[model samples]
Target: MKQFRLHKVASVCLIAAMALIGCSSQGGEKAAPGTQPGASEGSGQQVTLSMHSWRVEDTEGYKAIIQAFEAENPNIKIDFKPFKATEYNTILNTALQSDSGPDILQLRPYAPGISLAEAGYLEPLDNIAGISAFPKDVLAAATGKDGKVYGVPLSLNSTQFFYNKKIFEQNGLKEPKSWDELIATAKTLKEKGIVPISFGAKEGWLLSLSHGVIAPASYSGSGYIDKLLKGESNLQSPEFLQSISRMQELIPYFPENYVGLELNDMRTLFATEKAAMFINGSFELEGLKKLNPDLQLDFFPMPTNDQKAVITTWVDGSYAVNAKSKHKPEALKFMEFMATKKFGELFANQFKRISAVPGVSTDDPLVNKMAELSQSSSTPYLMVVHFAEGKPTTKQALENALQGMYLGKLTPEQVAEEIQKSAATWFPPFKK
Candidate 1:
């Protein structure tokens, strides 16, 4: 009788459990087609994705952007992690190689991004609905050699001269219209006990950035770049040598002991009003503003002998999905949102950068001026945009040679020769 009673109790419990499961099935929402087995869009199950970037300074900006994304996707959350810029590549590569990277990551533009895709670390974004909105040139930065788009272009960066408006006004200076005028302005600033340019050579990459700002106008912009790409010209060409010489000429006006200084030191000099001008990329605007909110800043492209200025512009970076991510659908949804105009506007307004997405405009007058300048006259940032492929890339060669030149270990001619030799070793057109 006791055994019979125990079996009756067991049967009643089983019936209760089945009734509860039936209630859940009848009342709960069904999973969306093609979704994961237990989780679906608006199914009340939340997912968190990890994202990594090198823009540590933009932490707050990204937080606000993520907040907006999360609001639209209540079931999804993003955790953004940014590492120091100098250390990011190594860290990201290590994580990716081990298949332990974040679900999404910020990619370096052009060859660097392509390499990640080629290594099978990145997912191809060809089928993403929003990728079609970007221009081909913009898309090229994140495209692999196999013709797959691996990321969404984030911003178009322009390298130029950023000047303190108050300093220029106090020094009785007008914007220079030619190379000679720029030299004269620097001389006047130096005479007034002001550092004419807040520049440094400690970091090799900045040398390339400075070159992008100063060289394009000297080489006649895209025309010269095309010649170099086709094997019609080399880095040792007179125009290219002239560009190298221009960098040498600016050394006298640089901050004292500039060779020992890094990017932050250079920025401090300018932001504190200890220096009159700085040659840097448009991306520095937000950081400079954050350093000194009262700073009065403006920018101008470096001018050529012919008095025409061409902005050196390139796609700065992109956001890519990791191929090893377990949450590909959710990560892809975030990527699709990033490619939208809404995200573009949010990015531009928050970061004060020129959005790669078309039709996204900024209210900041200075940023607007940059956008206008880009549209009117621009050239690809030569080394990074075109010659950044192969072992010991031309970009790397130029950066190293430029650093040597700054330290008086190499002359402009020698720097040019070294770069030419490096490019010839791997660049197909140069080999021909």
Candidate 2:
């Protein structure tokens, strides 16, 4: 069996510092672009490259994936290093500033990726052969303002409701076809002494995610987002305010003291069957399974009043090469491999995620259903995909405002006003 090792964040920093010190001792210079540092074709020289990511939970999955790559390229070894998601941005920024970052790094999607590319921290991959495998919209997440592709798109995530199949069967519940039916079902579940929804508001990000799933249909999904982006509508508009109000409507169905609970608490409640439903991303499927391997689960999109389903989708993140790396040639080789259908299949099969590469399909029935929902009737995740380029990103503003609304410090109207005010401060469209 192929083998790979995982590194903690502190060890990753120490290893990087040691590598740079050893290079100095050898008087090593940065390799020219497109040139291999020490190894060449059949040269028998070994090279090790470091990769950094924010997914500490994906260690096993990445270990297997990296093993496949290492098996194919025997002379190249990769040290897969992952940090806590909450600290990754700061760690990556610090490493980049000191020129001690990993050869390959995971980048946050959209505006954050563009920021790095603009800062010259990432190598441009405009001419990479594998980049042609992705569509223009998918590539947009990692493309810089200068029109250069800076990373390989990894996964497309859909936010929806994951339900406990066993509980639904026991309660004689079927998937809700309309908003009213969904409310009725939640009421029925709550009457039976079961938590209708496993959700928490302690982390501001989770509130934003929950809003993404619950509120899209209220404002009519992409139709309204387009109008908002073009200055035709504002967050304080009636329809948008209704969207915020919808989140408040569902507050009664959430667990007691949910505002004090965090993500892990929410996941535990759902995975252990303490709750009947969970609203989250496609990325959570494997995690839930790991928590309870025997858990019987399925997912569905939130239904609209008109009976249409609306799933919110976004490119989660991507993999990029550090512009300062001495292993540019080998790092590019790995990037090429990541863009291949082979790697795409491995990623989808192992992680149960929706791979961004075109024509890549998953064996997981639930993942397949998510893809179908996305293709049939889906909207872009509004805040991160469009309004995150500005300072006090629309996402952050909405999250904070929602938290305040939940705490009884703000009303739905006030929440909408705060979002509009924050956006107007930096968002060009809103400035109009």
Candidate 3:
């Protein structure tokens, strides 16, 4: 039984005060060359450390962090590179296997962390400084089955149905509180010639958002995933099947070529007010803000058939050190810098990420409201947290199968059976 505790954010004034106070041991001191071995010293024999991440929006945020870090240690240079979200894993996998990976790697803790750590490509960070600042459940996500910490969590993410508040108000549309109401609202919106939802299904990975947003309300308190893993239940259960049907019902409200649209396209549709609603994780709020600061946005949990709305959240975005990096010392120094509370503040305030570090708060009003919703009723994203180990995991299979459903090539029952079939290969005796 993993506890889900939503740590409250500290005041912005307090965070700013702390940043000015320079509490971390690094403080504001520029050391001489070789003063701290791997750290940058004033003598300026620069140590360039490369980092790889999937967040393009984080470029400026990280640059600010790097600037602060370099202020104290003038001899180190950080080379940060961001890859496309869809192509990141493939490129990272190749780089790691060839011993040509970045010094610092940003990754998702579940499947990717597990695979890289198992292959000895990620360095365990059990001794990382300031690690105790993170909540136990948050830290646990980045720890492997072998009890070694391979990554430090950067954010705890929550996904909800983000709707254009102004659109809803202008159209006389009330936020739906039940699955049936949701469909009715969509129908009404479609009647008025507006896209009801702006979900992008073309990016294979984005398909999971279709169901992930619905998983919490459908299965959270039931210990459903645990039963499936222990072989006491399966995806074919009536309850699970019905959940798939709930997602399929949204197809008619989407764009005709919804399967051809990528996530960016969906964001454009919503931010441009072409779509009334879209399901997205909190990470997108910052980007959305930049896209249209005047865009009035609000969110509600994906309404369930049973009418118990629960926010689906996951511990997402972690930083891992490459096991074979020649600049381990420099990389470790940067990791220590990230562990600081000030870095957490910067992450929350500047990058618009829900910081994993304690006592950090965002100034964004919408983010704070979403955080409150998360605290009120939330559950971890199921497949990301509970899938049995194997290729084509339940997460992967669900994504693929849902894409079929979006294309009208698969029924809800077929989707359920497909998931069971995929899980059966990894967990024996899976129900048919």
- Give Cα-based local distance difference scores for all models: 0.81, 0.80, 0.74
Count of residue pairs whose backbone atoms collide, per candidate: 0, 0, 0
- Regions more than 4 Å wrong, model 2: 1-42
Per-candidate RMSD vs. true structure?
16.0, 8.2, 7.8
| CA shift of 198, model 1, Å | 0.3
Model 1 residue 53 distance off true place after TM-score fit, in angstroms = 0.7
After superposition of all CA atoms, the RMSD between model 3 and the true structure is: 7.8
Indicate the residue-level lDDT of 375 in model 1: 74
Off by over 4 Å in 1: 1-40
Q: Flag regions of model 3 displaced more than 4 Å.
A: 1-44, 220-222, 428-432
lDDT of 2 at 85: 79
Per-residue accuracy of model 2 over 60-122 as CA lDDT, tens digit each? 999889999999889889999999877898999999989999999999987776677666688
List clashing residue pairs in candidate 3.
Answer: none
Query: Once model 3 is optimally superposed onto the true structure by TM-score, how far is the C-alpha of residue 375 displaced, in angstroms?
Result: 2.7
Error of 3 at 187 (Å): 1.3
